[model samples]
Target: MLLGEELRLIAYNTAIKHNITTSMVHKGLYQLGVSGCPWKDADIVEALGDLGDYGVHNLFAVERIARISEVHPYSRVKGLLYHSYESLGVKERDENGEFIAPKLLWKENFFNRNERGEGNAP
Candidate 1:
């Protein structure tokens, strides 16, 4: 078994390379476990969950997300973040800076808004 520090390093690299966090990696692991992924394939499963332009972030709607994989390819993940955030009872940040997606309908639009500072662009 890998030490916590070693696993942390792996997670750190994953975060840096994928723009996600170690905790998110854990989410993937959680999904894999809940899905009955084999113990020997845990590492692969974790990496798969963390591998993507958007990677994983503990969200998905109309389907199982974390603690469960969404089987990507846009059509599966598209427009899901909004509902994911919604399911958590947020329309965007709630005065403290949580749930920053801003209720957009599509994932690309959300990312576009995010790139433009969510209309803070000037």
Candidate 2:
């Protein structure tokens, strides 16, 4: 098992090279339970939840991202930032700066806004 400091270093280094953050990397590692792994960019993208240009955040999403990037000695989780921007719809930012998906996809498609029926509510 790697020490916490070692994990931190690896995450920090990866973040610096890939323009991410130690916290993000650490979260990925912790989520995936992968160390000294070998994943690729595609893997990272898929691992990141295949969010389809949406900045939706989830534990599984980030975990998959971390696993996928492990293939390369220096891998970066790309496109998520882009997804974050593209996913932003009507809702700007809540008091906590969280981007909330709009209830209506196109006003008329309110019945199927987020693949969820109008009656759907979590």
Candidate 3:
């Protein structure tokens, strides 16, 4: 089991490398249950819920979103972060039932918006 300080360091490093907030990294680790972390699934769900629409768009935030989908398939998190699902390799279909490639959607929504600083919502 990892110590709290160790976990904090991991979160900090991940935040620095990913260009995301430390809080987001900490929350993601808690959600992922790194080293037997005590945070429950409900806690993770609530944390993600508090992030709102724009917060969910952050690059690091996608990890937590994907974790939620893996643990809870019927979760509202999936619907909330629908666009992110594609980026995380989750399959998505258009209204016409045609496959929508995650790479294209990721480039258009994440990378492009990131270049414009539109994804950096406060």
Where in model 3 is the C-alpha error above 4 Å?
Answer: 34-60, 63-89, 93-122
Model 1: residues with Cα > 4 Å off, grouped in runs: 39-42, 45-50, 54-56, 59-122
* lDDT of every model, 2 decimals: 0.44, 0.42, 0.48
Instruction: Tell me how far the alpha carbon of residue 86 in candidate 3 is from the true structure, in angstroms, after superposition.
Output: 6.5
Candidate 1 TM-score over all chains jointly: 0.36
Q: List the residue pairs that clash in candidate 2.
A: 38-71, 39-70, 39-71, 44-68, 47-64, 47-65, 48-65
Model 2 lDDT tens row, 38-82: 554334323333332344344535533433333223234444433
In candidate 3, which residue pairs clash?
none
Specify the highest-lDDT model's number.
Answer: 3
Q: Write the per-residue lDDT of candidate 1 for residues 1-122, one digit (tens) a residue.
A: 46667766776676677656667665554444434443323353334444433443554411233222222333343334334544543343547866443221344554566697873221
Question: Model 1, residue 121: what's the lDDT?
Answer: 20
Q: In candidate 2, residue 39 scores what lDDT?
A: 52
Candidate 1 or 3, higher lDDT?
3
